[model samples]
Target chain A: MTKPLSPGATIGILGGGQLGRMLSVAASRLGLHVHIYEPAANPPASETADRITTAPYEDHDALTAFAKDCDVITYEFENIPTEALDLLEQHRPIRPCREALRISQDRLTEKGWLADLGLQVAPFADIKDAASLDTALERIGAPAILKTRRFGYDGKGQARINAPEDAADALASLNGAPAILEGFVSFTREISVIAARGLDGRVACFDPGENVHREGILRTTTVPATIPHSLATDAVLMASRILTALDYVGVMGVELFVTDTGLVVNEIAPRVHNSGHWTQNGCQIDQFEQHIRAVAGWPLGDGKRHSDVEMENLIGEDMDRLAQIAAEPGAALHLYGKAETRPGRKMGHVNRLR
Target chain B: MTKPLSPGATIGILGGGQLGRMLSVAASRLGLHVHIYEPAANPPASETADRITTAPYEDHDALTAFAKDCDVITYEFENIPTEALDLLEQHRPIRPCREALRISQDRLTEKGWLADLGLQVAPFADIKDAASLDTALERIGAPAILKTRRFGYDGKGQARINAPEDAADALASLNGAPAILEGFVSFTREISVIAARGLDGRVACFDPGENVHREGILRTTTVPATIPHSLATDAVLMASRILTALDYVGVMGVELFVTDTGLVVNEIAPRVHNSGHWTQNGCQIDQFEQHIRAVAGWPLGDGKRHSDVEMENLIGEDMDRLAQIAAEPGAALHLYGKAETRPGRKMGHVNRLR
Candidate 1:
């Protein structure tokens, strides 16, 4: 058996946003040091990490140094450039593996992978040019979402097409980037399952969390989601199946759309996700810590919730209510120490246990 | 109202152990930068801090630089020298105030302050030397404990005098350090009240936790501590009174011995204490966040427990049980990321909620 990483082992993290910041904290709590690799100066994770390499993702030399210093490498986001991953993988193991990244990075590839695994996903078709866009629009129709196959987040690089004429403009707006047209589904609510797969292939999943979004940004997630037990079971099973298929290690977030008939896979995050923030206050093992443990080659933690919980994101000016939220009984408030509170920026979050 | 500290404002942290580490995490969550001033390299807090100044406490130049960079200063321990406090006070605001540190550093002074505040304390006497030791022994009697006046923690720098003949040897062992002789109380249990005092004198105290000690090191603390509501109320009142008397800001821990008649003040830690670790899983706002809020000039958070909780320390080889603990239901494991786990070292802890 391969020996698991010890407390002093260094774990290299890619990306330096709030997710990376929380992951660094969790890794530090597990006696594993973190070295953050991000291009931005004063990235959130740098504040709590053992070291930071402020170099561009394409800097192979810096990536080589980061990989050399880390016992294992993990990314906080799925949109990591393939070349960066390829460079790091040559020197160190990357948890969740490149296959998981390849599948999750592209919308079309992700949907195709899920369909191949016998999982239901929204009807989708690739659009390469104006002609293909016309065909896709005819097939998928108006009111469908045309999204770039890669590097789309927080409602960026995606457009809603409401008319046949809007299709040409949407394609033009994307700057001729590769895109996918997805047929819209009438869903009752959105939910996500956060699960981890250990190096030993052990999979542990927390209960599904019902999600609410504002302008495509996650607003809140309530655990013990308002769904049938069988559906929740199916969601967890679906997440486990995906992880097993990819031979994944570390945490992965599986977003699902609750349809009238059943749950359909919406997307997959190859790293920790905002929807699982409730675990920080609601469950015994948070998604961050579970990811750290899994990447460190340790056994997965028990994903148990002691109380019903609701997590509300402190988006932009919503942070002004920190005092009021802090005063609420049984509310756990966590703020990302970002310097500026721009519009739609995720400043922090509060988790309330009921 | 005083304006809350801005995101770019630097927070000066004194002492650099795990408490400071956790406090840095909390502060960073709010976008505040941290500068750690510690005498040792590789301090736990240094791992995540924006900058670290490793110099002796009395080094004026280093201390001046640290104070100048910080908007406010707070400490993780009470053993800071008076000169260091004076130096920092001249440059920036120091939370918990200098009076709190003075009272807490010296056992004699702390007990005297408690008695002056009309708080219950064990019978005590000052022992200067061997001659005075005899007199103190006569007053406090056998089975009394002799502890140095300053710089003692985790049951160090202390010796028990069971008989008159043991007095001289105990006094000799101190090597002429100023000491206090206290009569041992037949206490049934030990508990600690962790409370935070805001700049405006607002006090928030968490539920008292019953602490279990192993070899004078805190092993476990269970919330909803098996105590009567009246006793718990008394503990909170005592903690509030101590904070108010000191005009304290930030979190303070009041260790108490539960007697048949009432509670007696055992010691006062003018910073976060291990007994408060349960807050990470049990309370709305943990001691670290409360401390950060107090120092940041923000309103104090509600210190309310959401669930019954138990915290167990991972000491030495006990860290090996981390995987087992992680797999246990309702267990939240926290490792300190320490490089070594020598005997008597606090490697990390785990919180279990019911």
Candidate 2:
């Protein structure tokens, strides 16, 4: 087996958002330096990172230098530029692999990939043009989501097809970008599996957590999701299967819809997911550290939950209640050092132990 | 009461060792910035700190600039130059107070202060010259330790007088430094309480941890010390008395000797201590964060222990078994990104939950 990264080695992280910020902290705990590569001048992750390359992804010189300095490379976001990643690939290996990123970058590709792997995915149809949209609408019907194949996140880049009459308007909203129509599924709750795979190919999954969304943003994730024991096992097995199939070497957040029949795959994040933030307070090894371990070629840690936690995101005005939130007895607050608190902006999160 | 420091305000930390490194990280988690003012270039704390001022404490310009930039100032170590502290104090307030620093900086001073509080302390006598050493030795007797009054740590600046014959040699070992003769206590065990005092004068103490020392260096600190519940309460009460007497703002590590009679205060650290490192994995709010909260004028967080933990320091050669330690189940490893490993140099620590 390849040797795990020695202490003092650098881990290059693409994208310097909250995920990268948390990942940098985890890497610091493991004696690893993080070089955050982000276009923004002073992104949230830059504060704690050893150094930050405030250059655009298209900058070949910056990408090459960052990769050369790092022993291993990992991205906090899946939407990193292909050219930058290709240049970095020449210097250091990227964890979660380019294949995982490529598949997850496109909604159509991800849905098809999951279906091909014999997984129960949401009913999705690719809409290449008006004719394709019409044909898909005929097959899938209305009350679907018209999401852009690329660059969709936090309920952005998506349009709701509430009725067949709204199809034209929904398509128009995407500005003619390549899209996919996902037929709605009646599910009792949404749960997510934060799974990790070490370089040695051992897949481990944290217990699934039920999620709540407000205004298209994740509000809270409660661990010990009130699902049947068998469904939790199925969710973990499904996540494990996907990770193994992708040959994933880092943490992936698999979102699932708990229907009457079984768990249906909703989406997967090829990096530490927001839903898994509860693990920071609930488990010995949080998702950030788990991702860092996998990418560093270290043995995966036992992520057994020691506490039941409900993680609530502090979006925008939610931070106004900071004093009261700070006084909450069992709350573990993690604030991203963001300069501004714009509406819907994620300022921080508090994991309240239940 | 003064208003609490805002989330984005900077907290200047003096001395960039592991404690500063951890405190910097905790500050980041609270959305606060840390400017680590350390003389050592590329110190472990600098990696995680937002910025580092690598100038000697004697540099007035550097110290002044650091203080001007930070809303509040704190330190990871005692014994900072008085001139530097005076300059910083002109611009910003130093938490835990200079009084606490002064008392803890000198072994003799600390012992006297503890005794003045009506807390049980080991017999200690100030030794200025040869005559004082002889007179103190006559009272405290043989088998005592000759410790430097100031600037000693990890067995440094201290020599043991095991017998009457060794007394001369031990005194000579100190090289004319102001010393203290501490009579050895026949204690069954040593335990430490990590205590905090907020700006609001609220006090909270973590469960006392039984400490084991090897070569005068802390080896392990296990929570739930093998002491009666009564002694634990007494230990907390004693620590509370010390904090209250000092009007201390921030966390302090109070080492105690658990004898047959009761708990005796061995010493106190003005900042977070190695014996309390297990709180990182065991408690809702660790000593570092607790210290930050106190100094920042925020309400003290709940210091309740959620898990039983044993923290072992990885000193020098102890790092050789890193692979084994990393593989151990329920182990949470925290490595200080120090480049070289020398004898007795603290490289990292591991917290293993039982």
TM-score for each predicted model, relative to the true structure = 0.97, 0.99
Write candidate 1's Cα lDDT for A1-354 as tens digits: 246887789999998899999999888887789999999998878888888999999888999999999999999988888888988999998987899999988999999999999999998999899898888888877789999999999899998999988887888889878999999988999999999999989899999999999898999999989998999999999999999999999999999999997989999999999999999887767899999989888877768777788999999999787667766756777878887888899998988886
Q: What range of 10 consecutive residues in model 2 chain B has the weakest lDDT sum?
A: B162-171
Per-prediction DockQ: 0.66, 0.83
- Pairs in clash, predicted candidate 1: A29-B335, A31-B337, A48-B48, A335-B29, A337-B31
Error of 1 at B211 (Å): 1.3
The 10-residue segment of model 1 chain A with minimum total lDDT is A322-331
Residue A169's lDDT in candidate 1: 82
Tens digit of lDDT per residue, candidate 2, span A232-279? Answer: 999999999999998899999999999987889999999999999999
Q: Which pairs clash (backbone N, Cα, C closer than 3 Å) in model 2?
A: none
Which interface RMSD values do the candidates have, in the order shown? Answer: 2.0, 0.9
- How many clashes (backbone atoms < 3 Å, residues ≥3 apart in a chain or on different chains) does model 2 have? 0
* Residue A183, candidate 2: alpha-carbon lDDT: 95
Residues B192-298, model 1: lDDT tens digits: 99999988789999999999999989999999999999999999999999999888888999999999979999999989899999998887678888899899987
